[model samples]
Target: MTLKHTISIITFLFALPLIAQEPDPSEAFWNRLQSHCGNAYEGNLALPEEDESFGGKKLVMHIKSCSDSEIKIPFFVGDDKSRTWIFTKNNGILTLKHDHRHEDGSEDNINFYGGTASNTGKANIQFFPADVATQKMIPGAATNVWWVTLDDKTFTYNLRRLGTDRVFKVVMDITKPISTPEDPWGWVD
Candidate 1:
């Protein structure tokens, strides 16, 4: 081959990786969340009027377990340790699921209801609309939408039920991570 053609080929090969590179917000968010593994933070109800179960309680979220595909965060409300938030990434799509357990480690009747993000979303936020499983589990929540936002100072979990007046929000202080709390109900360790 001519020198000019060889140089052109080399240049194109060198630029191939860069040209193929695309920013992935889901991966960024997942890495940011994984960074908090083994830490716990405190939060308060952003919409106290909407959630009585979280009112007058000390709310804590512990990034207790993490893996390549999933992360399990235990959410403690005062002495109640029955809730866990599970985040999973599959084929570039992110999903959020709620896992509830009784004190004896038994799964709650209402559990594993959540949604998957439409795409990579943004580096700091992701919106999850109720999935088929969630809709099947709770017909009334078929229109539920959940979103989580993360930034330098805070991480927030929010929910809104379309066609209803239900909303819940919790904002945790990422700047002041506290002592990691106990495992949620049903946690083996």
Candidate 2:
């Protein structure tokens, strides 16, 4: 073969690995969130102001634990530490799961129901549509879409149920850190 062709093939072979590595938008988002690791932020409901349970409660989110592939964020509505937002990443894919537990550290029936990212979203946001697991776990939740948006000033967790009038959004001010709350339900240490 000609030297020119041989060199071209050699360069292409060297670039194969780089080309095979898909861009993971989740990594950037994860790192943005990880920047707030070990910190807590206080926020309030921004969408519906008439939430009976979350209306007057002090809503706090603690970036309790973080790892290379997962982040555990405990969301406390008043004294109820039963809700946690679990963000897990595997093979460059991201999934969001809700971990619900009772005060006794027992799993709730409606737990771990969340979705996986349908695509590698932008740096500031990623959308997670209800996965099959969520559809099987909750009736009528098949249309749910959850997303988290993070920036230097704020972190927002949002949910929108397709074909319905249900939407939930919580905006936390990351610019100001709050005292980390206690361990969430079922959390050791």
Candidate 3:
């Protein structure tokens, strides 16, 4: 081979690995969330006033634990009961299984089920609760529709009821840092 041709081939070979590595858009978001394991953060649900015609109400959830596997968040709407959601990521999609049970290991108002939460570039989170058969349980129960600008520190949901055009925009803001180096997941007893 000629000298120029040999140098060209070497350059191409060196650049192959760099060219193959593509940046994952969800990496930053995933890393930020992963750091919140075993930590709790308080956030409020802000709903638009115009939606009051449909009887809108703001809700808040206390995120007790967060990890790559599962997230345990407690919704403090009316009762002190917590909803420990077990998350399983398949491919690029994330499925959160709702385990509605008390701290004593008893069933609550709802039973076990799986739900899909879509992360669209942190622009918003769309939740669709599914049945055990993997069908839509709630026609439109998505909540906390958040703005894209706050994607780094917050998440929003667009909640809807079954067979209804009424969409409630609820926002959840990350308030305080609850995770530390000592115990991030809070798994320790």
Candidate 4:
């Protein structure tokens, strides 16, 4: 065989294993997270975030009480901005619901709900909120784009204002689970 042809054959053979490798990291990560589909925990998050509403100021938020279905989070910003995250999973779709209110019980800047992400529900560290329409938004509203990252036991979220380039990040450490159903927000009588 010609030298060039021989080298081509050898390269092809070597590349087969890489292509045929057992599961990809992403798949493995997804599977691992699926195991914790019904578990919850508590932890802390520390990250820098910026937004136009705050005049390009970055602040830290506190997170608590985490379960597969819901998470309670408190913002470090003044005025008692605390929120609860209700997550629902169904047929591989993970949805997010937000409720931020003061002690007096008033709406907190329009609670966010119906946010969806891939739902293997694994414990793997992952990043999300990958919609371009949501990434560019202005203040006073939540953008279509939101990102969440999970690492073993920590979860982080990145959000943008609706219509501008303002970006905000929230780091969360789960405290405990309040429920166990995969889809607590599912339709029920």
Model number with the top lDDT? 1
Report the C-alpha lDDT of model 2 over 26-141, residue by residue, as the tens digit.
77888888888999999999977789888888999999999998899999999999999999988767899999999999999999999888777877898999989889999799
List per-prediction Cα lDDT, in the order shown.
Answer: 0.92, 0.90, 0.48, 0.47
After TM-score superposition, the amount by which residue 56's alpha carbon in candidate 1 deviates from its true location, in angstroms, is: 1.8
Q: Could you give candidate 4's per-residue lDDT for residues 1-189 as a string of tens digits?
A: 999999999999999998987555445544444444445433232333323343333223333344444444333332333455545444545555566565555665555543556544334543344333322332344344555666655567666555776565655454344333222221121
Query: Positional deviation of 84 in candidate 1, in angstroms?
Result: 0.3
TM-score of each: 0.88, 0.87, 0.55, 0.45
On TM-score, who's better, 2 or 4?
2
Error of 3 at 160 (Å): 3.2
- Candidates sorted on lDDT, descending: 1, 2, 3, 4
* Candidate 1 lDDT over residue span 1-189, tens digit each: 999999999999999999668558898899999999998999998885656689878989999999999999999999999999999999878999999999999999999999999989998999999999999999999999999999889999999999888889999998998987777889975
Instruction: Show where candidate 4 strays beyond 4 Å.
Output: 1-81, 118-143, 161-163, 172-189
Stronger candidate by TM-score (1 vs 4)? 1
Winner on lDDT (2 vs 4)? 2
Candidate 1 wrong stretches, greater than 4 Å? 1-22
Please report, as a residue range, the 10-residue window in candidate 1 with the lowest summed lDDT. Answer: 47-56
Of the two candidates 1 and 2, the one with more favorable TM-score, higher being better, is 1
> Considering lDDT, which of the candidate structures 1 and 3 is the better prediction for this target?
1
| Candidate 3 local Cα displacement, residue 187, angstroms | 11
Worst 10 residues of 4 by lDDT: 180-189
Deviation (Å) of 91 in candidate 1: 1.2
